[model samples]
Target: MEPINLDKIAFQITLHGGNSKDLAYDALKAAKEGDFDKAENLLEEADKEFNEGHKVHSKALRSDDKENRIVPTLLLLHAKDHLMAARSEITLIKELIELHKKID
Candidate 1:
């Protein structure tokens, strides 16, 4: 019956978000070059990282950290930004895959 630390959760989430964004960027680059398989592989890796970040978020929601939150910082905002970017990239990747399929 203990609560998780908000600072730690934010740190882990930020790391995962950054990694996922990097993978997604690589996926987009590969897709643009017509390397569909490489793109798919990169996207898969991004999905794994994103899922990890999501787990951290879920932990925060389940714990008492949400209600006891103190000051708001920019780094936490940056983490949210990174997560949004990753999700947007995921959507774009799906579109790219569909486009490639159409071209084939």
Candidate 2:
């Protein structure tokens, strides 16, 4: 595929990844405030955004032929970094939310 196309996908991944992370953080905030229902809803929204980002990343990876893989550019790497960090943040925040629920 063209580099411009790859850049577009990378930008999308980063955007969705950032959205996911923000939603996760919002969920944690809601949990801290004892609004468990809202927290759960936010968590679901975050998961959806995360999945969208992951799908774009997967599509970018799969777009390449077997003989020649997609070249990872700096923007792509940055996007991946955002995605992984968001994933980890959401996972940990889920645990933290559960703990908060138990405490409450």
lDDT of each: 0.77, 0.94
Give per-model CA RMSD. Answer: 2.8, 1.7
Q: In candidate 2, what are the lDDT values of residues 1-104, reduced to their tens digit?
A: 45437789889999999999999999999999999999999999999999999999887777777766788899999999999999999999999999999999
lDDT of 1 by residue, 1-104 (tens): 55556677678888998889888878878877888889889989999999999888776665545566534457666666777777887878678776876775
Clashing pairs in 2: none
Q: Considering every candidate listed, which one attains the maximal TM-score? A: 2
Candidate 2's TM-score: 0.92
What TM-score goes with each of the models? Answer: 0.75, 0.92
Model 2 residue runs over 4 Å out of place are 1-4, 66-68
| Model 1 alpha-carbon miss at residue 26, Å | 0.5
Residue 30 in model 2: lDDT: 100
lDDT at residue 57 of model 2 (Cα atoms): 88
